[model samples]
Target: MELHFMGTGAGMPSKERNVTSICLNMNEERGTMWMFDCGEGTQHQILRTSLKLGRLEKLFITHLHGDHLYGLPGVLTSRSNHGAETHLDLYGPAGLRAFVETALRVSEAFLGYTYTIHEVEEGVVFEDEQVRVLATKLEHRIESFGYRIEEKEKPGRLCHEKLKALGIPPGPQYAQIKRGEDITLTDGSRLKSADFLEAPIPGRQVVILGDTRVLNKTIAFSKNADVLVHEATFGQEREALARKYYHATAAQAAHIASEAKAATLILTHISSRYQHGEEQTLLKEAKEQFENTHLARDFWYFSIPRKTASHS
Candidate 1:
């Protein structure tokens, strides 16, 4: 999976970063995109890119903070105007429905799409056999939440050469080989699929935490994440202030990534006080402890690689 950083500022919009929003590209088979957070002006950010409002299939909201949810009305309305014929579901904290209804009612904005709002609490917020999303309580002043998205493990790749050498034709045997089963031949010969399959490469995990200062909560969500998108609302020198505000600093975000054994750390929700060029400084600081730290910027898109061919 890959993440497209749509907004990466905190509290308010910045010239460099907007607010908290990111697009998650899951398996291509889904033909849809997932989103985390939708700060003010999120639709405007989408206007500057090729993102289709219709492609937004699922939304994982961290909290109901104005900076994180103010843009949701605009997003919903745009889908109606654009004539999107897909369903939209939102997962967030309690009172989410009230917030959405109040916003639409007060603004008198209309939408033409069917939508579902799930007011989530700390637990398995959403789950399918293929993917699962779990939420945890955070230390923010409000009842904030963090999410851990876990994709199901993929099957092992088939070693075609081994199967070919076993005198099995390349048709149904390939499926059995990848399934790690023994195919008994009509002649009473047994062929072990494991002998023709390599170890499976694990699917990617992503952890996105809300505005918080609790390292333990963030660490719990970020364990073994291929990408950890955490807030760095304060600079290292202002670590104390970060704690006071229930936010995180660049160093602290990196430390959480380190403890979680995340494959890469993407420091986002940056403070505008730090200039664009200074993002490199944040990257350097995180990389000191974690080698694969990268900064996410707006209008970026990523592609998730395909998993195994399934006829099992």
Candidate 2:
């Protein structure tokens, strides 16, 4: 899986960054993409990338803040205009449906495809055979939420070479062997499926948080995540300001990642006050606490490597 940052600025747009928007690229995994937020100018950012609007399957809004929203109507309209026929699912706090419907209504925008708006609560908001998404309340001025995405474990790789060596020809029976089914060969020889498979691969976990102040629950929610995306809206020197605005400083974000024992921490939602050249300072502050911290910029791509059974 890979994370594509469309915009990473906080509060408003700047020359160096836009606002808050992220796309979880799952094209290789599920042939679709899931967006985290659609801030203003988000579609413009997507135009610079190779991402297609039709590939967006789901959108998860963190809050109703203008920087976090304001682009929903345009994205939806554009998706329809582009001739996308697949259904889209939206998940967010209460009032999301009203906000979207009102905008579409006032603009006279007609969607060609159907959509579902799910008002998320503090729990598992979405789940399917491949993945599960959980939400938790976050400490922000408005009602915001953080999401935890857990991928289901994958089955082990079938040892095709071993089966071939055993004089077994490729056929539908290979699929049955991969499913752990023992079968009798035409010659009456028994074949054990488990003996021809490697260990099962472990699932991966990722945590993405909205704008918020550091909280204890957040640490627990992000525990052991392979990738933790948290907002670093201010430098460590602005701790008081961060708290006042219900935001987090780079140091504070790193603290949570350290406490959670996360494998990698990505700091985003940067304040425009810090000029382009000053990003290394914020990154340095986070690295002091957590060595594997990264400062995200617009259009940056962070690939989360899949964990193999041997690695797990």
Candidate 3:
């Protein structure tokens, strides 16, 4: 899995970054892409990258703020024009189903594909053979939400050398053992699958926070995550303003990341006030609290390594 940032700016678009949008590349079988928060001009921002519109199967809305979701109508319409015929599923907080439906209806936009909108309350919103996605409510003015994506535990690999040593030829029997299935051998002896399989490796954990104030619930959801993507809408000096606006500052985001014990903290949802060459202070404030912190930018991608899917 890989996270590609289409827009990383907070309230408004700047020369360096567009508004909020993140694309998670999960591959063809599951879905080509999973989008998060489409801000204004998101389609235009996407034009600079090689993302495919038809494969965008899911759109997750964090909040109803214009800065975070203004681009949804445009992107859905653009995708229809760009040959996206597959059905899309949208998930968000209360009023989301009505909001998107009303937008499409009021505009009388003709979409080739149908959409099923779900009001996400909590628990797992999406899951498959490979991954499971859980949503936790965040502390924001609106009913915002944070996501915890946990890759499922996988099956252990087979030891082909051991099979050969046991005079087990490469056949269906060997395949069954590799799949952790005990099988009766030619000598009428049962072959234990564990003897030919390695130990199961744990999966990666990633947590993504939307526009919100730093809270302990959010911190708990991200405990020991491999990567935590949190919003940093202001520098440390603007803490009062950040609180007034129900947003987090750079230091607060890093502080949350540290408390969560996240391996790496990705600071996104940057303010437009920070000029093209003036993001150093934002970086500095965050780094002071958390060493493995990175400031997010447009088109940035993080590929989370895939583990073997559970066949149990």
What tens digits encode model 1's per-residue C-alpha lDDT throughout 1-312? 668888988888988889989888654746788889999999999889777778888988898898899888888898789888788999999989999889889989877778899999888988886788999888887888888888877767788877677677888867876776788887998888767767665666788888998467668678878778888887777888899989988778889989999877888888887885877777777778778777778776655454444444
**lDDT (CA) for every model shown?**
0.82, 0.94, 0.86
Per-candidate TM equals 0.87, 0.95, 0.93
Candidate 3 vs. truth: CA RMSD? 2.6
- For residues 207-281, write the lDDT of model 2, one tens digit per residue: 999999999999999999999999999998899999999999999999999999999999999999898589789
Give the alpha carbon lDDT tens digit for every residue of 1-312 in model 3.
Answer: 788899999888878988899988777436678898889998887888888877898899898888888899999999898888899999888888777888889999989988899889789999987788899988888889998888766558788898888888899987788667899976899889988887776788988888898888888899989889999999988889899998999899899899989988999998888885677799899999999998889988887765554445
- Model 2 pairs in collision: none
- Candidate 1: pairs in clash: none
Which residue pairs overlap in candidate 3's backbone?
A: none
lDDT of 2 at 216: 90
Off by over 4 Å in 2: 184-192, 310-312
Question: For model 3, what is the alpha-carbon lDDT of residue 196?
Answer: 82
Clashes of 1: 0
Candidate 3 to truth, TM: 0.93
lDDT of 2: 0.94
Highest-scoring model, lDDT: 2
